[model samples]
Target: MTQRTDVVVIGGGQAGLAAGYHLRRLGIEHVILDAQTAPGGAWQHTWDSLHLFSPAQYSSLPGRLMPAQPGQTHPDARHVVEYLAEYEKRYELPVQRGVWVDAVHRDGTCLRVASDSGEWQARAVIGATGTWTRPFIPAVPGRREFSGRQLHTVQYKSPAEFAGLRVIVVGGGNSGAQIAADLASVAELTWVTRRPPRYLADDIDGRALFDAATARRQALDAGHGDTGGVASLGDIVAVPPVRSARDAGLLPAKPMFTRLTSTAVEWADGTLAEADAVVWCTGFRPALAHFASLRLRGTRGHIATVGTRTVDDPRIHLLGYGDWTGPASATLIGVGRPARDAAREIASLLSG
Candidate 1:
């Protein structure tokens, strides 16, 4: 028998769950397919110490608030996962987890989505799989020759794992800074950036400016043309200079790494930096390869879309994609408005 629905939601994370919630509210028939055994997607596997920079209010979804007191920091990955599990049970959201979708294809006017269990046909599909699906590591010369272990920030869990190891963190983004700062006391840490960082002060208060900026970044990634303009990597905010760590000599400024072979890092000025380990805070890419039919490509093979619409196939939607506007797109606080907006768009298409 061919199972049919008005829409098929891929990924049971924040975006997909929100989309399912709205669809149910509108009385639209849909089924959520998640690869993981539970909700919360990548959060289920994130680092143990990871916490959101945004406070509670900004982290809330459209219909409910994340449990927290005023002025408290955003929940950590474990809390987030538990919260999503609660959200699912609270609303009785119909999400079928532990079933990985193998492929999705357009079948006539409907979409044919396949999972390990079976296939589903729907009038529309929502790609709520977040941007963290693929970690973006740049190709530096000699990377293959380096004998040390190299890992992306996504694979990183705790600094304790690297205690007493000489580590070089590449990229000056918040991830790099946080990782460097966290490991400074436990390990030999060297922070390397290609250029000076554009740092922003941490917002202790959950104000509109902070929340709105996050929402805007999410919108940009969702294919919504709502941002002002683009700027260089240096324009993205970084952590304030770690004067204390610096003064303690725990955080040393290392030269920009120009090449990475199998065993060593060649600095821009021709010095060799040895490392027992390397954490590439390079960034992430979209998880759109599964939708090869979309034919959307940009510089470096990036997808070109604003909020939900893939630039090539407006009929298709992308959720939780990052850098749609700039660096802010990847944050949880920023993804809410876009998720809601994309939900509305998805709803409209399904109804039509």
Candidate 2:
């Protein structure tokens, strides 16, 4: 049996929930299909020590302001998870959990969304699946043969498991820096980067990253040149913990290794370091596999989009992947505007 709806949102994360909120406000018939069994989206899978760079007020969804965390300016992962769980219930959003959308195909006037549960035929489809499931690791030579416990940011939980061991964190991004800082006291930590990790001025707050994301988004939206968003690897915010780690001389960068030697990493300088574990913090690509069937992706492996709508297929809109779709579209506070615009456009199309 084919389930029919006016709009089908392929994720139930911050992006999908935000879209649902707007769709409900517009009185549009919509359903959010989520792969998770419960709420909290990807926040449920993040490390226990993780905290947002932005404060509670700055990280709100469209209709709700996340309550401030006690004694902390920025809330931890648990608090964000609780907020997401509450947000969905408060709005009575129609979210069908555990429905992993596999592919989307053209079906005359509507798009056919095939999922684990069944098929949904909808007038419009919104792809909001964020990148947590598809954590990226670079293709460094000998990575496969390295005789060390390898993990990505998604599998990281705490420093408890790596105590008194040599752990090399690879990548120059925020996650790499944070993980290196996190394991400093617990492990014999080594930070490797393609380039020296750049930090914003200490006086600059975390809000600066958000500001840069919004500004870059505006420029892209205005038909300006395509530049990377704040999420790019080079721009590390001087968050309190990261700053402390840097000031204490705990965070040091070794040039990225030329290759991995069975049980070690060999740098271009011929320096070899043995490691008990390696954490790959290389950032993620968009979770766009489900979109394969539409043949919508251009040569760049990304759907050519104009303000969330696919240039190849007007019936499909890709939201919340990153700034290419909207300002900070991947973040909690940033996804609202794009979600709103997508909802309004979908409503207009349905009405016509």
The top-ranked prediction according to lDDT is: 2
Scored by CA lDDT, what does every candidate get? 0.70, 0.88
Model 1 lDDT on a 0 to 1 scale: 0.70
In Å, residue 62's CA in model 2 sits off its true spot by: 0.5
Model 2 earns a TM-score of: 0.96
Per-residue C-alpha lDDT of model 1 across residues 1-352, encoded as one tens digit per residue: 6799888888888877877777777787888888888677788877666666556666766577788744444556777787788888787888998877777787888888877889899887878777676899887877777899999989999988899998899877667766777788888777887776544444332244444555556676688977543232233332233434544766555668788756667876778767899999888776666576645667678777755676665556777665462233345554565666666777777667
State the lDDT at 27 in candidate 1: 80
How many clashing pairs per prediction, in order? Answer: 23, 0
89 in model 2: Cα distance from truth in Å?
A: 0.6
Q: In model 2, where do residues sit more than 4 Å from their true spots?
A: 203-206, 220-234
> Candidate 1 regions off by >4 Å?
69-72, 204-249, 261-263, 298-300, 323-329
